[model samples]
Target: MTAKKEVVMGASTENPAEIQDGGAMELVRVPAWEVKYKLDRNPDELAHFVCCRDLDWRRAVCGYEEPEAVILENPTTFCTMCVEVVQAHGGVPGSGRCPFDDQPCPDDETVDRMIDERTSRP
Candidate 1:
């Protein structure tokens, strides 16, 4: 009998606290903040600000040399930098207590829906 490789789901190696949205993990597009930057002259740079860069510790995990360089958005994982900033500021990082009071970090369904909406747009 051949043994199957058991794949562990939920939370990425890069971030243990990250939330997993199961299958939605397959379709994560750019960060939700991209909705704002889609029309900006400096979209890349401005998008980074949405994840927050004021905290010094964020620079290490963020891995972006310039705000304009970050583009990948993992649906299963909240931005580590964003998480740290939220926790540091006494707010939570997930759907319950997202840093942006107006825009809470959405759940898996919301993330996937946003991606679909963006793609379906004319």
Candidate 2:
């Protein structure tokens, strides 16, 4: 079995603002501050690292299995450079290729299709 891993955010924290719902139903709106880091790390790399760390470290603390991979809303914009770094480390970018293999990266259309499929799913 692949070794389980967890990622933990080092110096980043999220704060949310609560807003009242205007509709008849009682609702609370919690607007979160986007994830932010203290160090000058590449955003994508940071995200990847955090994901890995969470799977490798924090999952155990929280009592869960490590996630195989993370999904980003905008894969292209979120971690282009980090993908390159992960690729250099032998991992595939975009298609979840093994970092230790030479598999071809998934094309943009594949990613788009995945996004569309996910969004369309109920």
Candidate 3:
């Protein structure tokens, strides 16, 4: 049997304070004010994609060369860049965040409903 390493989920390797587990860490999508860009991004490209760029050490994780290129493409992961873009443009008019933003564990009723719906689907 192998030893189970305790993992500190959602810890940024860039920050010394976030490191809790002595083993591997999980990459976080949220960008706190102190986070520096660890991913490989070019300065030249960074100059153009202002829509996805945050006015901080965070780099363009989306890697779009032009401004608002992500909108032209399909959105997948929830990132700080996406949040910045949405908020910068007056944000969502009403309540309720994007369904993709986070995956909270379904409550008992919600889970039961989902299971019933899926089972009933043709």
Q: Of models 2 and 3, which has the larger TM-score?
A: 2
> What is the C-alpha lDDT profile of model 3 across 67-99, one tens digit per residue?
121121122334455445545654441223322
Q: Could you give candidate 1's per-residue lDDT for residues 1-122 as a string of tens digits?
A: 00011111122335333325333332353343333212223323222213321211113223333333223343233345544655566665443434534344546575445435433435
Give the count of colliding residue pairs in each prediction. Answer: 0, 15, 0
Which 10-residue span in candidate 3 carries the lowest summed lDDT? 1-10
- Minimum summed lDDT over a 10-residue window in model 2 is located at 24-33
Q: What order do you get sorting by lDDT, best first?
A: 1, 2, 3
Q: What lDDT score goes with residue 86 in model 3?
A: 42
Better of 2 and 3 by lDDT: 2
RMSD per model, one decimal: 17.8, 14.3, 18.9
Please give, for residues 42-102, the per-residue lDDT of candidate 2 as tens digits.
Answer: 3343233223222122222223333532233321233345456555675644444435345
lDDT for 76 in candidate 3 is 30
Candidate 3 clashes: the total is 0
C-alpha RMSD of candidate 1: 17.8
Q: Compute each candidate's TM-score over C-alphas.
A: 0.32, 0.29, 0.17
Where is model 2 more than 4 Å wrong at Cα? 1-46, 49-71, 75-88, 91-98
lDDT (C-alpha, whole model) for all candidates: 0.33, 0.32, 0.29
Best by lDDT: 1
